[model samples]
Target: MADEVSDAGTVRADAWIWSVRLTKTRSQAASACRAGHVRVNGERVKPAHAVKAGDEIRVFHAGRERVVVVSKIVRKRVGPPVAATCFVDNTPPPPPREFVAPVAVRDRGTGRPTKRDRREMERLQGLGGDGPTAR
Candidate 1:
């Protein structure tokens, strides 16, 4: 069942993605392929595209891109440990949260931001205008 590899030496791109736990569901994997968010060997592929071992897959989902090289092919969804062995993850680490711009938060019941407050919030977000008013 979960441990068995495909005897055909290849599987559908969408099925392989889900079986390897790259996406949450098989349907989501298919949708991603249809939306052109999945690529195989550097080319966009359909959901039914054949995926074999040693192929590189690039998927963009959940606001992040994942790049992995297929190490083993599985047709049925497997556990995390088994799924982990199916691919060689090549995705880079995400940027640190500290480097992200902080959102401006106002206390509950606070009225609309005053012009000065709006300007300050814009400055903090690096969206301030370059005109003299920005200084």
Candidate 2:
């Protein structure tokens, strides 16, 4: 029976991370998976591991991580169409994000710039020619 096929694994953790447009590529997803940062249903798993609808997952990225539940899957790399099928966020509610104004970094004088550096700086500043008005 067609139903006999396992409909399990709504999404592979790596594929989900990859298709959701998280990591740039599937290999990166696998690497991330091997790093042991991803957890399914509260347990660590590998990249090829699969997740099914209602399965929960946790992913740590950058400085912060998120937890989510699998809602659906798109085996192929997906665009915005299947976006909704991917999953649901279930991370523990976080406190208000703290925003700290950055202090402008000043590079100490490392001697005068070479001719190329000066030209590049001039172009960057748009001193060479007319460009879009600086916001």
Candidate 3:
């Protein structure tokens, strides 16, 4: 067993996750527990749950859940890379966001057009080409 220091010489799992910026805040961590968004050792856990090194932890966020094993106990918010060191990612991150082409459109206006028409043109400036709406 590792001897972790705390205010009383011990650390809480929920607090640790909060300080580590895993879930934003301790209360939100607890809310995650209530919502069954967190698990330990393949079982659901509460905010007051106790965790030790080598334990498997999972967290849900942004429409996805992450699973990792406890490598060490840390009570400070570290950089992303350092935070990444806290555990091993069990699953790959979600797919990269990509823009999908919008449905075909027949733009309005004919002559010089109105100010709104010009703004619309700027908005669709990067859709591969000028598009059917382009002049």
Regions of model 1 farther than 4 Å from truth: 1-3, 6-8, 129-135
**Per-residue error (Å), model 1, residue 132:** 4.6
Q: Number of the top candidate by lDDT?
A: 1
lDDT, candidate 3, 1-135, per-residue tens: 123322233246676667556787788878888788888888888777877767788888657787777776666656566667666668666666665544435455555656565556556664343567555
lDDT of 2 by residue, 9-123 (tens): 4556798777766567888778878999888888889998977777777887665687777766556676654654566766677665555433323368877776666655666
Judged by lDDT against the true structure, how good is candidate 3? 0.67
What is the lDDT of every predicted structure here?
Answer: 0.90, 0.68, 0.67
Q: Which segments of candidate 3 are over 4 A away from where they belong?
A: 1-10, 79-81, 95-135
Clashes by residue pair, model 3? none
Candidate no. 1 TM-score: 0.88
Better of 1 and 3 by TM-score: 1
Which candidate would rank higher by lDDT, 2 or 3? 2
Ranking of all predicted structures according to TM-score, beginning with the best and ending with the worst: 1, 2, 3
